[model samples]
Each structure stands twice: as structure tokens, then as C-alpha cells.
Target: MYHVVIGVDDDVEHALACVQGVTNLPGDAAEKEVTLVHSFTDNPSGASATQIHSVREASEYLEDHGIDYDVNESSGDPAEVIIDFAEEEDADLIVTAGRKRSPAGKALFGSVTQSVILNTDRPVMVTGTARGSE
Candidate 1:
């Protein structure tokens, strides 16, 4: 019974693809538990309501597959929230989308996937989409 945790962002297609890949993995389909996580930074400027709805939509996608999972939402730096949630849930695998970014974008914004890879002791699975696919 592996605990698979999928991190969802604003990209719905990428998120759905990531979930599909995980569910298709051997033994994953039989697992009774999974987790869908979405994290948002608490910027005073506010965040999109659509982003919150995206998380719910992701959870619904899992349900449609007859897979059981817990849906989570949090406010903070994305990387921190993801790492903390995985640890709290004792996840066996953490899955997320991988997007290539310019060196400047990486340096200034910092990638949550990169941070999670560095910080977590647990195994991480990243699904990459084609450039400009989203």
C-alpha cells in the first residue's frame, strides 16, 4: 500500500497527466490510499479562486477513477507546504509536474519541484510535459 502524493498547480492538463501516469503504474491502481495536494502562497495581492477549484477538480478526477484520496490545501511557500504535507502523510512517493524554466526564472522564482527533490528523503516522481505544451 504505497502512499502516492500528487502536487497540483495551475496547469490542469499537466496535473491530469501526472495523475494518469501514477495511477497507471503497476500496483498503484490497487492501492487504497492516495493524496492530492495543492499549495498557494499567501500573497496580499490575493490568489485565484480558480486555483482552489482546480484542486477540487483534480480530486474529482481521482474519484471518477474509483480511487480514494484525501484533498489538501495550504497557504505558504509551495515547496515548504509540499514537503511538510508529504512528511505528515508519510508518503511513499511524491509526484508533480516538471516544467523547464529559464535560468533567470529558476534563480528568481525557485522551483518547488526542485526544492522538494532536495529537501525530501522520500522518493519523488516528476512528470515532464513537452515545451510549450501547456
Candidate 2:
């Protein structure tokens, strides 16, 4: 079985889309396992609304497709957390969302997706933002 780690955030649609993309990849869907990971920029007492919604949506989709998966959460740098988790899990692939941001904004604030992609040796699949998101 191949282990796959997918990074999720407040954007439920983008997160779900990335998961769906995995199943569509060139391979037997049954041979892949998914791990939904959330890296909280700000530490919260409990599960945030976005995290709950994202995980719920992902779980439902995985369940419907009879896929084995689990949810993971960590607090700190988003890119660092995701990369560390992927390494710990010995994942074969890492999926993340590429937010809809202008080039200037990305240059100013930096990008978690970019950081992860640059740092990790494993392949990364970055799903673009949904059509309507800002």
C-alpha cells in the first residue's frame, strides 16, 4: 500500500479537490491510503470550525469510496509541520492547495506550498484554488 499525505486548511473545497485528485491519479485507488493533515497557524483550544468542516468533508468522501484514511493536526509552521508529518509517515506523495494569491502577495508573504515543494524530496501535488475563492 502507498501512503499519501494531504495538507488541508480552512479551504474545504480546495482540500477536498486535492483528495479527489489523488484517486484520479494513474494507479489503483485501492492501493493508496490517505492522511488528511491540518497545520494550525494559531494554536486553538479545540478543533476549529474550518478544520472540522474540512475533515468532515474529506472523511465522508473517503468513506463513500471505501478508502482508508485518518486526520492529523499540528501547530506551528505550516510547511514544516506538513513536511515532517509526511516524512514520519513515510508517505509516497504530498498534496497541498495552491491558494489564489497574486504574485506580489506570494512574494511578500511567502508560500507554504512553495516551501514544502522546495524542501521535500517526495513529489507534491498542489491543487489550485476553486473558481470562486479570493
- Candidate 1 C-alpha RMSD relative to the actual structure: 3.6
TM-score of candidate 1 against the unseen true structure: 0.82
Q: All candidates' TM-scores?
A: 0.82, 0.88
Error of 1 at 58 (Å): 1.9
Error of 1 at 16 (Å): 0.8
In terms of lDDT, the best-performing candidate is 2
In candidate 2, what are the lDDT values of residues 56-110, reduced to their tens digit? 8877777777778888888889899999999998999999988877999999999
Q: In candidate 1, what are the lDDT values of residues 19-53, reduced to their tens digit?
A: 77676777645574777777776546575533465
The C-alpha RMSD in Å for every predicted model, in order, reads 3.6, 3.2
Cα-based lDDT for every prediction:
0.76, 0.83
Native-referenced Cα lDDT, model 1: 0.76
Best by TM-score: 2
